[model samples]
Target: MSVHEEISKKTNKTWGIIQTYRKLDEKREAEIEKVILQCQNNEAFSVDQINKVTEEINSFAAINHLPSRKFVTKQMVEEAAQN
Candidate 1:
């Protein structure tokens, strides 16, 4: 697959895993600060730690590939309106 597609797929997969095991705190916006994992267990992972693990999937891959904001276009808006 293309790099863009690969990145998107890899990033999304990693994000999904993160969502299942951990989540960014209220102040994590725009910053790879801390992601609390297993809140009841007091577990957490930092950006660096996450990157280290994600790198196992791809040498150049990192959890940071996740999108910070949704991209929307006129066509997309129209498509959503149709739906």
Candidate 2:
């Protein structure tokens, strides 16, 4: 399978996992939303930076079946683009 296909499959699986964990209660969903907002509001990451970082991390995770910590660096992006 192509990298894009692999990524799509992994993302679908992950979303399924998330959906399974979602509660029917509004309070539960609100709590989850609060945590998500807190993380997104972190001073270190602007909205654009967060989106970029999340995309790269998810891309790497989906492609490699690894955690975000193992994501390729900016240098790797440059190198890959140059090739």
| Candidate achieving the largest lDDT | 2
Q: Which candidate should be chosen as best, given TM-score against the real structure?
A: 2
**CA error at residue 71 for candidate 1, angstroms:** 41
Q: Can you give the TM-score per candidate against the true fold? A: 0.27, 0.29
lDDT of 1 at 65: 50
Query: Residue 4 lDDT in model 2?
Result: 100
lDDT of 2: 0.47
Predicted structure 1: lDDT: 0.41
Q: What are the root-mean-square deviations of the candidates from the true structure over C-alphas?
A: 16.0, 14.4
